[model samples]
Target: MVRYIETVLVPYTDKVKEELDLPIRQQSIAIFDVFRAHRCQEVLDALSKARIQHVFVPAGCTGELQPMDLSVNGELKAAMKNEFMNWYADMVAEDLKDSSTINKVDLRLSVLKPLHAKWLSKVFHDFEVKERHYLARDTGSSAIHQDRGINIEPHVFELYIDLMCQFKPNEVLNYIKMNEGYRLEQTLQICRKYKLSEATAFLLEKAGDIQGAFGIILQKLQAKLKLFVDVMQGGNTDKDLNVLFLEIDTLAIVIIQLCQRNSGKMDEASREALWFPLLETVMTPQRKLKDIDNKDVLDDFNKLTHHILNSMMGYIALPAILQKIMQDPAYNTGKFGEVRELILGMLETYNYEQTLMKTCKNLLNHDIHVHLKSLTSAAVRGYIPRGDNCNLCNKLFINQNETDSVVVFRCGHSYHLPCLRSVGSVHVMDGEEMWACYLCSHSKRGRIQSTRFHRSLSNPNQAALQQTKEKSKEMTLDSQHIQAIDAVRKAMKTPSRMAILTELSRSDTRSVRGSSGIFHQENFQLRLAPPIAPTNS
Candidate 1:
């Protein structure tokens, strides 16, 4: 299981200890789980003697390195199993025909081949099973759980991509378990949002078994869009996704070949045949954001070209364009502009800013920043986060920011209060209807009656309903108070339970001033009955 690179072993074999200088005292190293079982006691002793740090992992889980282990691995395993069965049947037939002439080599071949085949199958099976389970676990663990409502963080895009890219598919798959069955949709959403039809087609190709899988699904979409777009365009230029399917297939083949070369399976000449041309064709300086002209196919490639190169290399592989946007400032700055314009456009078109601004003054004034343009595009198109700019704006704010008159929502939208009030009146003639946020239009407000009833609730600094000793004894049980406590107990049932309970509690206590009288959480304000005259009494 110890998967040392061929080059690493070569140094030891050639006795070039000096040339192969490995760090004697490294702080950290990340090894795939494939090699964990090979960690011998001697290595452990060496670690102890040198005071070096190391970690161990289980086997049969190196999905990133093994392409067969990605979506295609399952089918490959079944194919291997089928091959084994057929081979076994042939061996049985041969042995039955000539039992007396059966040799030890024949027996060994019969036994060993199936065992090896089974071994390979099991490796992939373990990966598939664990991956499926991990997704389930992650879905349940996410902040978007029922009790917590929704947590719309802009940083999630970055976090998800970081985790997914650094780890193998199985390693990162757990992070998006709830989104497992919806991968194709999510992938398409990202591409469509970013206008990355090329990337979308590439991803769909890798999710194999076209007859039942993405190929057919996307074809159906292509057909549907053809009808929709052709009618609108009057048949001028309505290209369907199927037109690009062949190109996508060709790209995937090139990628697999590139991976084979990288893995050292290809001869040097063959490697040169593929690598030299590709590198020469696509490589470009960080400054030039786009390709200017067309030359030989092997001419210098730019960001978009490199992105295609990576996709042609592997579905899960991170394109240089994406990586640059994530890390390199030269590229990230450019990418940020694209993201900013996209956000502004989405907000303007959907009137998101107006809706979110109704909630608080803070949201109205805050600036927003977005990253991972590819992923964000998907989120916007699919409404995955159901709203945009939530996480981006939060990260944009810091202690130095002076926007005290603001509030943010779960979907990462923000708004200002004073600007919101001038736009519309907060009115509720009766108690049944939920109040509306004419500003953000996110959700109808819960019944908040008698707005002026609880002054303490408006300001977090104030204490509402002080528990004096005299009143504490008489107020043994307020039904509403008891209900509030009971709800909290229910919320504590899970880790996310407290968030729901806290919101409910806030709703119960909150009140606002209205045109008629004091308001309470139930959406009604009370005008105290006029006091009777002392003489009359």
Candidate 2:
């Protein structure tokens, strides 16, 4: 180092000082990285003899502390990128010009090594040193001269894409995901055109277009172009692949959510109607289906139809899955084909139906027994007939005439014997006439009318949708809602409660029942206060 400095530094400093004749410092300043070799005694002695005062830059702060480190960045990188691109193009062109030898991996590597070597070589054979500053500025050895304008690497995006095409795609995908400098739209378009679905999915998800990414993955799976595991792989497992794994999970969930949201927009009928065709499409083995594993043809139409009807989704409707598809787990999802949706729909529907059935069972076991016992007890104990008129025909009871005497229910409702016979509501129970009051049945629960069960046969889904909307509108609970509830509580206590039940408006009965649900833990918890046991007298 001493011999090199004596040979290079002394001559350069002396020539600049003597010839340039500019404002000169007493001693030159030298900067070096904080390394032992660069700050050794020998180096200090050499610097002192050369009249150069040395400053050692702190570790990892060279960019801030050293002028050369700062100057070397930005512009130099862009120039290197441009040089690499130019070298690549020249190599390809030269290969084309030569005899048609395939540009193998070794050939490409040889071309790349030479280009890198050229960049690393510091012997600048061509140097333009201006002895005089154009502006007549006094000279400093490291004074600003070159403008060092921003280096523009022409077509860097395209060049980078070409590199991706030539190199390991997994590494390139990692770069594309992390680098914010990419023009995302252009990158996305190129990825699509190249059929790089994996990269395209990552870009789409990163851009917050998760639906698009999901569709891309599904398409790849549906087309049998890639397996789910293959699509999920962001890179080799030896690296951090958590982000990629999470991305696949998110994509799978998109379909499930879409299934739920879209299904919600339609009613039961529309859901059922739309489902059959989709199911049929899945069942109809395509000409391509036979190609897979060399399966037999599905030409027997009757057998196919029977198969459809008996399939898991078909039997229950999965008795019915349009609901199950929405809740299906996405992690186990691997492939997409005609049957995946069909099978999932069936299973999901079965699950939903199973849930509903179980709920109904729970409701029956816990809720209905109390009501049945109460009704039986009410019938046995009996209530007085207070009304003077027949509840059914609205005619005054003829107490003096046997033919038209009012037939009174022990439960307070009165109907003319002729009206009762006409409706055939009367039945012999325990050697006495018995009948269910139309009003009582209604207040107890909604009537089991065909209209209630069938909804609108002509347009059930639309009818259900409208019903759902109407139902949703009534969900608000305000003071009036509270007051109406309070009125029901007051009615249950009134001496005229059961008798006036038939007279209560439909709105009142519905309002009373609305706050009341079968699932209430305290459904029949009516009493003035806690019961007190009586002592035997």
Candidate 3:
């Protein structure tokens, strides 16, 4: 089965992918049964190689969840059974007429004839129709209604909204706004009945009842904070603590939005009462970092801190809260200053991390600089070799003395330097000076540029480039660094290199240092350079 999938199914999928002009990973999905055959490593490997995400139906629920099992397969089985029964009846009738026993050879022939003629064509036609129906249903209700039913029940829509509200309240709110039939009052009633405070608050706000929405949000926030206090004061499971933190963050967002909308109407006293406890939940350290052994719990705490800081930054009544804090005698001490600095530092670090993540994603999705760099490195290292002849001129490199004139790129294509330079001059005239390997350059037409790289180049001081040059001069390229770069260049050929790069990029320097000292003691010293101050002209 695995071999069939690899040899046949994947190739067919590739053909379809080409016809559709889709990228390698095109959100292709495959549903598989929970049979042991589908669960085998070989089958999974084939699916992954084809870039098809394989999802398994729950065991014993294939009939309900699997469309083929529900429709096409059932039809095919019934058609085959009917054909066999007809053949059996015909054979029995002939036997009764001849008054002789039904011959095994005749029975086999009867079964084989219908299987090829009647059953095969019937099953094929049925499968095609049923498969189309199944696909239409899977696509959406509009497609399903076009084929099956024009009108659906009101209760079905209600059930769907209820389910969506539980999982995705924001989506349900959007749906209610777009759909005229979906009444806000009815949805709000359902939300309140189900205790979906988030959805209820959203609906109330949409109804222009901002104060009501604020009240609901505030009530939920207080309840969640009280739960968090209880959990912290008493011994609670990590799961409970995590839930409390998430709830607190979610409620904080609602409160922030409400406060922003009613900023003029809301009084300072009400704002203080509403925001103080929420701010304290974040500003006051719930527990010492050393006391939390679980990494997940620590991460949750950081996430909650980020959420609280973001909410405060967005909150319209921030000035009121700051005034309240300043006027309080307890905050007059040095502790308030320390807490304020800590909050600012956390926010800065969080913003920096988010920016880094966005930059990395942009690079991965669009930048070709990394590929160009790899090509350049391969060219410098003489990794690209001539395959018995110069690729540009289509002539054999017979002269051993002229071999030094040959230039090979990292892509293993070689050409005479003069031939490459002639072509490169044309590219340079077109505003692209850095010539890439023929194969790599022609694979994509875009120039390699990154935001960070461009920013560094455009800087007045060129600080990043200066820093790089200084580092290079301080620690000249060693054999280890060359070998490591080579290894990375080689690994870039594999699909997994992207994931490896992402992981490496995200890793903290301390963790990397603990794992391996890439910088040796004899060659390098660990010293912190004093921060450079920007000069005013």
Candidate 4:
């Protein structure tokens, strides 16, 4: 401990002072937890000698007051334990492989080696740096000062309500009660806004706000009814219309029960205002013909009358037919003919409006196209090509005297008609009849083909084959180099060759001395050649 103070703490303090140009008396003091080692007389004397003022935290308050204890120390310990476990696992595997026995000395060495490598310190320092920011944000004096009023925003209460509904529905009231930041009215409003009926009831009943709860239920019912009415009035598709009817039916039952519970409390005017719109909306038939119009006023009136007569006839005839079926002797026998007739009638009635609408739309589209052509001819003069160059062939468009036709696409790129036809033909081979911009199409095709090729290469057998081929090529080159090296080493290791080399080295040195009067080591070339055997002759 004394050595750590002298070597690490003293040097750190001196470096800080030098870097910041701080005077000895102005340097910051160090605060420590109330551990026995930190408070000992020896450590205190060492800190005093180094001019490092230190203070200890009060007993049993480290968890709350000490930042390291609050954040950094736990993470540090966990990281060290993880590192130690990994090291121990590796050592265990090594021991099993070598068939060696383990002992306390091996375990100690395993732990100490990583410590000496400074692995734990690196992990602890990282954790300390990360925790420092959070400590400042959460435990700073400014953050510690709590607002002692119920001044939370409406959106915050909404978020709290949604969280409570998703995770803790039963504990919602308890959460609101515990958090003074939330008010009873805010909680009620959120519960109503999010359609949390049970939570609203709970909060209202807890606060003895029964009338408020009834009002919330009514408001939710009214909103649903309004949505249902809107969908019914504006909904075009049969599927959506049917779904809206089903939702309205379900809401109708709930609304009835709510009205029954508050029958006396809800006045006639409020009841009429709520129920009349829903009743009128439900009773009124969908105005499909109102959406269509004929150019002639008399023709439109005639068509409307014709539709009204057909509807009246169907309504009158269907009920009579239903009555006849009920009266039939075979009605109780479950015969297929009657049921099939009923289903066919229902389908025909359902498809009549849809088929008429489609026919009218087709006629309108034809008329619109005719009008557009006339308008275009009156307002526009001639076809002007957007660009001069063909995007595909990279050639300029020829004049009308030279070329038969030119094509201009909606994307503003121009091409000769023949060039566009050729591009289309090429794309047709890939199951595309139309052509996009050449660069975009090429890049898209390349990406698709590359993805398919990559998927094929991802197969394990193909990967293994590729890896084996690479390794074999590498081994072939390695073997050739190894053989060459071995041959050289073998030639140099021979006793006869070694003696020749020694003699050559001495002669080269003597030659150098004779030439310059200063002996220098000469570079000698050593070549290995294969021995040739003598012929049988």
Candidate 5:
């Protein structure tokens, strides 16, 4: 190869240089893959003497840098090997025709052997007619700028914005929007450094200074007026996801309106007439549209939305609507004002339910605490054990005259333990002995008798008796049980589950408001869905 380059390639290049009237480059380029022979000292010296500059292609970069070399040489080697195999097969078949046994066919061993040869890859050279310039390096900042962005440090973002803002005007907002890791205050200061009113206002609004954002827009950008509208409005073509946030916000407001109507405390007929129809109007159309960012359909979509809300206005009275809106727990008189009433109202309503439950629990606990305190205080100074006589036996023979009776009632009655027990007046109540006056305990005696009868009777007496000795016993709910029942009824009144289900059911669909029209796929509209380009590549 060194001899071939010195003898053939050098003379050919000299002849071309002498004959051609072209200003050619003095240096020659030798290109090839990583071959052992090409890297030898003798070959390098020969190429150096011939002034042929070498370009060795990297191991895997042959496809790109030396594309033609691999295609021609690799295919040629494969084709030669295939032809040799065909020739050898033919030779073997001819030999078998002359032999008797096919299995032990006679074949030529020397001349018919498959051709085999070694190939040391030669360097590729193409003579240039003129001098050429090449770009070896490039700083691809443009490509880097077109990224989703990384979670970089706040200081780094600030520094980048500060440095790049001058070079690229309005670059600060783009960078800040890309990277969420930046501190608001740091970015704000950086924006202030360049006096970037737009960027400053954006940061301010993100920091919850809506008024300042507005002020900046009005005072400076108002002349050219570019509002910080969301990316949802900025040519976002995602038919579902792009408009998802907007759909949710709209549905939230709509559901809050439904809840508002539900909150009116109206009569059943009024609610059925007004609320359900309004609900139907809102829901029926919303069932058609969930999230749509297509620019073409959006105008019609907005009109449809307006029409639904307009139709709803017919059912709900203005005064009733105003009253319900004001009643929402988040009905603010200041700041965002009534706007917050609907969206935040959902949270407020749930919070109010929790508050009601907590209040009920607290009230119940307080009542029991007060009752217990009263019982304790009363017991502390309760009537001295009635030493007069036993209320049941009218006998205080043993202890009532000197000491206290075996048990004393809050009603100031006394009794011996045995007498009260025998009469079923005194009982072990809450691990303590208790008794009541015979007259005071008259109504309660039936309860004890009924209990005694309950313990004595078998399961056969499960049925209620027609004629009972006890004063016409009837079933009744306890006060606590009644309160609990009321709580459950109140909870049942909240249609939150239904509202959430309705919210989830919202789909990117299209339909007429009334039952006159049937549901159909929106893709059937040709203009909305252009013919998908064929994937030829």
Candidate 6:
């Protein structure tokens, strides 16, 4: 049946279509709790095709899919309550019609269908909201304002400001508003005339608004492009180039957007300072720079590194070298206020602090212990693949006599069963007649296949079978002798046990020296008395 959803959602909906929300607007989102659970490959493939970027919610948070879990669970209970009442009413009506009949079937149908529909609707809506809340912003640009006189009209300025404002509220409200006497129009003019480099510096030092700094950079890039165009057309401007402005602007924009997307992560500010110099080196004319000795820059570099460590917490183990550097009290505590401030600024740009906080709590509450148990369970299922080929040897034995028989190993690698069985008797560990892997020494551990050389060994004719059984018995006897030898070698380590065993071996009665009727001293004396003469008489 075609179900009409009032909004765009269904159970196991497409991810790209679902999570259109951005800046993590919802307190919770309903994604599959485990990425590997429930048609995840199909969903993930769809997301990849749709170019949807995502941060996986930490495990155990599906119960917290924002408002859905909170509100929908209660709604389900209420629906159940209503269903019960309705069912009761239906039963009463049926009883009135016929006092003897329970009318069980109709009563059940009345209560169940509506309640199920209601609960399903709640779940669908909850997921739909989560999807819609995460869609990326519209990225197409509509116009370019490239005038260079610094006195463009106010209305145009407001329109551009409004448009930019929609994308970056925190940036504008928290930083841009602080710059007085410099309207957006003037910033644009400065960008057109001085190149984005000079203008970005002017804005950063003068206006302190990062957005304004970007505005200047954007104009300078446009001017540089125009300059390039003019030169290609056989004309060159005498104006000196200010290339660093464009470079700084590009890097700054990327960093700022990262900050915006991550909800003012705590480490972003510091990282940005570090990121600028590295990015500048890429664009600078010299192509290399002297070692960065700026204390503020160094601190920011460390902060950026730490932030990356937090962001990729699920994957790489942070390098010990970096961790060691970061943990030093002198490095952390001796910094200037601006250096410290830069480091702290990064925290404002992303939620790394929150993630760390959550992790710390899990550690404290023995969540790690539970996690370790789960890991051990998963480990038992299989080894984590190192992206290498199967390491076990593939060779299998084929008994010359048996064509049909094959032996299997416990590890699932297969060999000719008949050949393997001929080599080793049935292992008592598992009922299967199997052979040990020569490499791993695990008998009955892998799958065994029949080989060409061993057709007769597998034959079940009485003569062949009897012969095979006799051979097996002989092998068992030999194996027992080997085991006995091994046991003797083990026992020989103790001098007293070895002495008792040696004396026992010397006599026909097969009794130890102390336990037999003849005492050791008496037997020796009788041997010396020449008892053979009395026997002849």
Please give, for residues 1-537, the per-residue lDDT of candidate 6 as tens digits. 112111333332444435664332222233444555433566554444434433455567755663554576655556566656775787678887887665555546686778678756765655544533331111212256433224435555444444434543323332333323337556555443433344344445344455444444444544544453344333344633234334434544554443334334336444343333332322231111114333443343344434443443322223432343267563345322323443355445335667888889978779778888988986677433222212221222333543443333445544444334544534666665334653355334564332111212222354356556555344333443345434444433232444445665685544554465334543233224545654554
Give the alpha-carbon lDDT of every model. 0.42, 0.54, 0.63, 0.55, 0.52, 0.43
Clashing pairs in 5: 288-509
Q: Which regions of candidate 2 deviate over 4 angstroms?
A: 1-168, 171-195, 202-215, 222-356, 359-361, 364-537
Alpha-carbon TM-score of each model against the true structure: 0.19, 0.26, 0.30, 0.19, 0.22, 0.17
How well is each residue in 1-537 modelled by candidate 2, as lDDT tens digits? Answer: 777678987778877887778445557777888888877899789989788888889998977877776765544565677777776677777888886874843346676787677864421211111211221133122336544333334357446665665554555566565444457788887677777877887788678665566567555433431232343233335533345433433543443333333445555665554444433333333423434332222233223433443442332344344344344453124322434544555456667789999999999987788888888887788456878776654545654533555566656888766555544466799999776665566557765321111121234455457556556333334454345444444434322344334435456555555665322325344456868999899
| 85-107: candidate 1 lDDT, tens digit per residue | 77668777787788766544354
Off by over 4 Å in 4: 1-162, 165-183, 189-242, 265-537
Q: Which is the better candidate, 2 or 5, if ranked by lDDT?
A: 2
167-255, model 5: which lDDT tens digit per residue? 65456666666556667887788788888876886788678664465456444422221111333345545445435534533543443
lDDT of 4 at 520: 35
Segments of candidate 1 deviating more than 4 angstroms: 1-45, 52-90, 93-122, 142-186, 189-537
Off by over 4 Å in 3: 1-180, 237-277, 280-307, 314-321, 328-338, 343-537
Q: In candidate 4, how many Å is residue 88 off?
A: 34
Q: Could you tell me the C-alpha RMSD of candidate 1 in Å?
A: 29.1
The candidate with the higher TM-score, 1 or 2, is 2
The C-alpha RMSD in Å for every predicted model, in order, reads: 29.1, 26.4, 33.5, 35.7, 36.6, 29.6
Q: After superposition, how far is residue 153 of candidate 4 from its true place, in Å?
A: 19
Better model by lDDT, 1 or 6? 6
Better of 1 and 3 by TM-score: 3
